[model samples]
Target: MSNLDSQTAYWDTAATTKTFTHPLHAPWLDDVNRHAAILDYGCGYGRTMEALAQQGFDNLSGVDTSPGMITQARALHPTMRFAVLDTPPTLARPDASILFAVLTCIPSNHAQKRLIAELSRVLKPGGTLYLSDLLIQDDERNRDRYARFAEHHDAYGVFETGDGAVCRHHPSDWFPSLLADFENIDTRRITVATMNGHESAGIQILARRPSQAQVGPVDSFTAGLEDR
Candidate 1:
């Protein structure tokens, strides 16, 4: 199977049965316009989008790789929009969007980088990307798994959970590097509850795409990617 399918396989069957609890901080959405286009990439069960809708924001679209999750989302929010996003990971929406808790679900380093590049492509100039993800934990249980997983995965912070889902935890410096293309607004460290019932340190970052004037020619950016 392809990597994308491997990544999503667990969620297809387990999403509806489990719950993801990522906290959305107030500052992350402080500047989002009410009518701006928002896409919750990796939106599991439409939870965050539902929260956004309740806060008065409109024009929201949620997409997940797992059909079961989309099934749950559409059923829960009949009036809201939700769709299943399959392999190749191209979003169907127009050129700009917001992402919440997307990075955590991606367990590979290269995949995370590719997703950031894709987000840069689809996000309109000045569009904001609000992100929340787990950080490498200091606890023994997590440390042991991180070490054990190194033998199986390319990155040290990625591991499979007891429930059979693969997940990634980030190093503090890695967050800034992953979002190198975006203009950072604010970052905060917070403790969070994991989907599998654990407390872990996590991060919240709010960043903005540079306006058109701030960016150089498209070829200049694409040139750097060709070699990679």
Candidate 2:
């Protein structure tokens, strides 16, 4: 099976037995508006969405690639919106229609690029984008792991675990560069404690899409020439 297929199957099996939602989501929770639409992308088992709903955010929705998770989410939260996205997403929302998270679970840079582009297109100017994922560290252990797995890997920093599962990590500089179109509000590295008690390196970021009216230096220069 392809990596995507493998991941989907893994998550489907995991849906009934695991809860992988990160515990430290305060960065995105601080400015949440009850009236605005929020999407929990890669929302597994709808745990995060359920938490948000309990906090009084009514206009919330979620999408996941695993049907098993979607099924569990729908069963648990019958009133909330959840969709199973098995293909390239064709979200019908207008620009700036939502605030969302690009959380963990993606296994490759190509997948990350496509998702970021789609989010950028649908995110309204001034909308918030929250991202949290594994960070590439300069540790000898990580380097050794990469060296051993790079030949058979699906993407950079991605490798097959001994258990035959794919995992990916990214460099610290990756997100800020990937999100140059957005105004970064905050970024911090934190140690994530997994359910199994193993700690992992991770980073969280909060960024805002610049309003359409905000012009760059090039735009300002062109506009000045036009007025002359």
Candidate 3:
């Protein structure tokens, strides 16, 4: 099976059956405009979208890679729109139209970059993007696992789960450089409660797309009309 299929299957079967208690986007959700167009990329079972709707966000939409997840999301949220997509999503919205994005699911470097590019394509200049993902732990056990995973995968900090799915973790210092196109607003480490009732180290990032108005040099004063 392709990696996408593996990931879909992993989420549909294993992740679905477990208990998930993590709070989604708690740090940045309130800062978004209530009426702004929001995309919940990789929104599993539409939980975050549903929460956003409860918080009075009317322009919320979501996309997931697994059809099973989408089906469940539709059942749980009858009024909201959700799409099943296995590839990097191409949103119907025009360029610079989206105002907020909550991305929580990409694990590989290529997929992460691809989704970031797509988010950048759809999000308005000065729009906010919130991302949370696993971080490469500093312990020797994690180091050993990363070293072993390097033998099988081309990227760093990757590991194969017992269920045949691969997940990548990023170092703490990596995201600022990776998201250089955006203005880094904040980056912090937070403990997340996982499906298996374990606390894992995670990185939460808040970034804003640079506004077009801020791109060029600005003249502080009129150079030719100084003596008027």
Candidate 4:
């Protein structure tokens, strides 16, 4: 099968019966302000969005690069907003935006950086950003498994996926520096048991834009001038 087809199959099978009950999901949902505009980045099959909806998130949206995934999301949650987003939109406001699990699937490091920049740009000052992605861990077995996947799939640059799908496993230490522009609120490793019953490690990142109140007068002056 082609790589994309292989990926679709993997996710379809894996996602068909999975519950959105990861430990990280609850905390991330709690962190979002009520009625906030949240984007489920790479929202495969609308699991996260559906979970958030159950928690009373009315303004939630789902964006996925995969058309099949988007189709499924729409069919399942027709009342909620689902869109195929090639890139972040020109949002009406900043601080109201939140992206979850979006950047990890991008195949280019430069593209990932640009995506982060776009997220930061459109987020309102003091807006929150939560990201979760597979991280290279210390387990030799897991490392070898990932290495084999990389080799088999010919995955390179910032992201890679083989038999599994399009996924980018970042180094554990990489996120902090990459997100240095934002206020790093919390970083932790979350171990999740996948539907297949295998445990995987991911980095959970919580960051915030510098609020207008936090920006010093000098910086605000520059920002104001730039806005003029």
Give the number of the best model, judged by TM-score: 1
Choose 2 or 3, whichever is better by lDDT.
2
Cα lDDT of model 3 by residue, 27-145, tens digit: 46566667776666566677666666777777766666667777777887898877776554454532222212122234456655665666665566677766666677676866887
Between prediction 3 and prediction 4, the one with superior lDDT is 3
Better of 1 and 2 by TM-score: 1
Local accuracy of candidate 1 as per-residue lDDT tens digits, 1-228: 246323666776766677667766655566566676667777778888777777677877777777888888888889988878775356676324445556666777777787777777766676677777789999999999999998888789888888777778889999889889888888888887777778889877778778762432121110000000
TM-score to true structure, per model:
0.88, 0.79, 0.79, 0.71
User: Which is superior by lDDT, 2 or 4?
Assistant: 2
Clash pairs, candidate 3, are none
| Top of the candidates by lDDT | 1
Can you write out model 4's per-residue Cα lDDT over 1-228, one digit (the tens) per residue? 134322444545544444433444565456565677665655667766676678887776666545667777788888887766543433232324334444444544555666566566666677666766666656675567567667654553232333454655567667877776688777777786533455767667777777862431111000000000
Whole-model alpha-carbon lDDT for candidate 4: 0.54
lDDT of 3 at 88: 47
Q: Note the clash tally of each candidate.
A: 1, 3, 0, 4
Residue 148 shift from truth in candidate 1, angstroms: 0.9
> Which residue segments of model 4 deviate by more than 4 Å?
1-32, 87-97, 145-166, 194-197, 213-228
